[model samples]
Target chain A: MNHHAAQSRAAYLFLTPFLALFVVFLIYPLVQSLWLAFQQTHGPSITRYVGLDNFKSIAVDRLFWKAFWNTAVFALASVCIQLPIALGLAMLLNRPDVRGRAFFRLIFFSPALVGLVFVAVLFGLIFEKRTGLLNVTLHAVAGFDPEFPWLQQYVMPALIIAALWLYAGFNMVFFLAALQNVSRDLLEAATVDGAGPLRRFLHVTLPAIRPVGSFLVLLSLIGSFQLFELPYILLGGGGPDNQGLTVVMYLYQAGFDAGDLGYASAIGWTIAILLGGFAVAQRYVSALDER
Target chain B: MTPTLSITPRRTLAKLSAACLTYAMLAASAAIVLTPFAYLLASSLKTGEDFFGSLFLPAGEGVFGVAWGRITSANYTRLISEFDFTNNIVNSVFLASTTSILATLGAAMGGYALAMIRFPGRRFVTNLVLFALIIPAALMLAPSYQLLYFLGLLDTYTGLILPAAAPAFGVFLFRQAFLSSLPPQLLEAGRIDGCGELRLFVSIGLPLVRPMIGAFVLITYLGTWNNFIWPQIVLQSPEKLPLSVAIAQLRGVYSQDYGLLMAGTVISIAPVLVLFLLLQREFIAGLTAGAVKG
Candidate 1:
């Protein structure tokens, strides 16, 4: 074979493993998920077509709505609460006068490496009623309630606190990088123009980091929507009154726990659509902001 | 940027106070962030009684008013002996390492082809990879489970490892890394030197993207190591379960055994954290590289 033919042959050979696996695992499963959403199945077998019944049931599904609301709350908290603190920390670290930047950065970023499952395991105990670290510390510091039912009464807040610890620093790293790349000249120009610290930050820093900020928001949203392992393990499957039910956890329960793969696929489809909507909305907002 | 305004005494005092406030916040935040890990470590050493007795370390008639004598290794011992966590640990090691290595090689190869090679349908494959990026893993859980069952790969490592080996995210990252770093001329040079295709890839293509390899391997390894849901669904046999599932199950069975649970948590977290500490630069760069660049 000539060089062109030979190179093409070699390229296909190189692509074989990834292509094969991608087809079998990703493409096939994705298409099958779309198909499976319309039909109910017992385990992996005994499927029956139910048209739009799965989606219809999920439409009025109070449990699914609760899961969606909980997930939305978490995502909102991530963007509003977590990302602001992250950006604030990033601003702190990005200061030219700051010392031990790397040390603080490492400390802040460490929990993110703990992974979601392990974070749940650790926080599972940390959110305990009286002896839990949170309650004890709060009780000592501010006369807070020692017997506050975190996993029971304040399930969403408990999940939010755990997620904040897990993700704030991770998001901070991104913000820090974006902050570092902010045009120093423009900031100095704003300072020279007698803009206050807040004003300068508003005009220069905020606009500059908007892209990364939005990206982090979308990422946080997608991640929040798929909140399964953390809540599943932390609350031990949708805590009291199913207050901690997440979309993916609900999907898992429907699929594995309840052995209804079809309903699970429908939930999966709903999550996909919601996430895709977030992506598009984010893109549109970012595009508008650029103008 | 020089100070356009003169530094009055009031300004100096303000700056100093601001610095002090910044330090205070950073210190407090760091403490809050690290308190749980400390709590985990201390809890793992305390018995069930001591767990309720003290917040962190048990307080007693020891140095610093701490009950050092009450610290115990029984939790770790129980994890291995009574709970058979050692088998889970081994299974985790096997699955994580194998999956990571295979994934890195597969992604590097596929990415190299997409980035460097001139062939038919390259655009289609590249677009396919890009399209795959937005398809969330959660979307595939149910169907993939059924597919695995149909293939009779459930309860086996192959079911878990094979799907993860060719992650679209890894391939896209590797593709970006190669496009930015790997030189077309270098590959041409290797070709002119009469190197075989495989040799050119293994020797020349691989070394050019070493940092990507490091980052991708660490990412994949850490991902597989910490992954819970997929394995929980796929693996039915207890012995085949990795540490993630094993730890969850451990908690399920012995939720009240705070020490044992914390001990298991420590085992699950320590290795990956240490690996991250060692290779944090590459890992962080790899992680944020995608968001910042893409």
Candidate 2:
């Protein structure tokens, strides 16, 4: 009994530092945010109890809907466009015939190391009207418009393109790992049976990598939904016509810029609920796949 | 089934073409990916006048139609002399290293307890960690800021580092690492040999999960180094601000100065890229371990 008591004591002592900070920082904030979501506040101090008004306002708010639309479109583009290129790159790298695979992967993955804010700074110049790298290269190559307004008129596309460059290779790392794990025996058997490359991929490789694919999809979606710093820095605050506004940017504007923490809390909860739906759906899909 | 017969001229030609195509595609993608980085480096070197005068380097009668003399270190020098980026760099290094070390230690200890010890509340704490994982960070932003305000820690590094040091994600990672890599029998033997609990953890448990410690430390350091919003919210004093916030402020003020902005970014990004290159294996392994295995 004494020995057991000593072990328990040691365990509690080990856990104390983490548990103490987690409770104060994580748990308290979580509960407080729940309460704050239903109230109205100026800054963090001045408060008024306006139950559900924030949520209701969000329901009908045009800017919030626009932000929602922009975020959804980004997420859709990420899944559809970016993930395919990532998978393609992974497939190419997974080939036994490919040499210098590591070198190629390092080159592709290097950009992901650059933080989103810095990416914004670099791409901000890259997307400039005349002297920007994109326009200059395009103009030289194909006589493309030198004065194209990427950040202004084509906000979502520009965001998607920037993100594609940043994340496609990062996601490719996951797909490559999955590809390398696909059963070689099954692949060889299909090949011997005269299964062409596309058929072999569709029949043998795709099913094996399905789990990792779903995981990457969810990861990309969650990340896309949380987009802020890229557009916030690149477009310099929602671009020309609030076209680059994201949910988190809107939340930051509400809380810090506008000094309405209450409405910000509401926006945060809305995002939480939406992301929760994604998680649950992901679980459901995985469960179905298991069955 | 017959390797010799499979080596026909048409088959060889087809395979060669396929290989060529693969190389061609990969090379194209690699060039596209590297263009911005090359542009960034080139842009940082150019003078303001030369920046607009040419795309990459100022075109002239020097080697390969490029004016070698036009490339200047003035932007970099100005950053150090005019703008105190050195201070921001120091702040970034301090915050990142301090937060990573503290967070790693706390996580390893917490993981050791939850994974190896048969305490009464282990299940409760484990459940709490899981619940905490799904809670969107955005939800807590307003409340965490308010909490800091009430505690009078708003502008302090403690306000920033303390909260981050206890990330549920780190604890969960270490727990998984300990559960898989650490054996209960070893700990029991250490206990039987009269080794103190803390000593056992320090010497035995930590060694067993050294890779996790390294990986977790790197992840936390990279995260803290790159993090903007939290520190931007917490710290008000200019001297206390880290690189991420500092760079953003620089952009705000010198948005038009392309050379200066590029130089600042190059400085901000180079260290992490070099670190990632050195620790690429451990970093990639740690990044994908949870996703792949779980």
**How does chain A of every candidate compare to the true chain A by TM-score?**
0.93, 0.94
- TM-score of every model versus the real structure: 0.95, 0.96
For each candidate, the DockQ is 0.57, 0.58
Q: Write candidate 1's Cα lDDT for B28-147 as tens digits.
A: 999999999999999999886787998888899999999899999999998899989989989999999999999998999999888888998988998788778777678899999999
Q: For model 2, how does the per-residue alpha-carbon lDDT over A1-291 read when each residue is reduced to its tens digit?
A: 887888899999999999999999999998999999999999889989999999999999999888888889999999999999999999999988999998998998888888888999999999999889999999999999999889869999899999999999999998988898899989888888888889998999999999789888888877887798999888878888899999888999999999889999999999878667546644634442233
Clash list (residue pairs), candidate 2: none
| lDDT (Cα, tens digit) per residue for candidate 1, span A133-228 | 999999999999999999988999999999999999999999998888899989989888889989998899989888889888878977888788
Query: In lDDT terms, how accurate is model 1?
Result: 0.88
lDDT of each: 0.88, 0.89
Please give the lDDT score at residue A226 for candidate 1.
Answer: 75
Clashes of each: 0, 0
Flag regions of model 2 displaced more than 4 Å. A278-291, B1-5
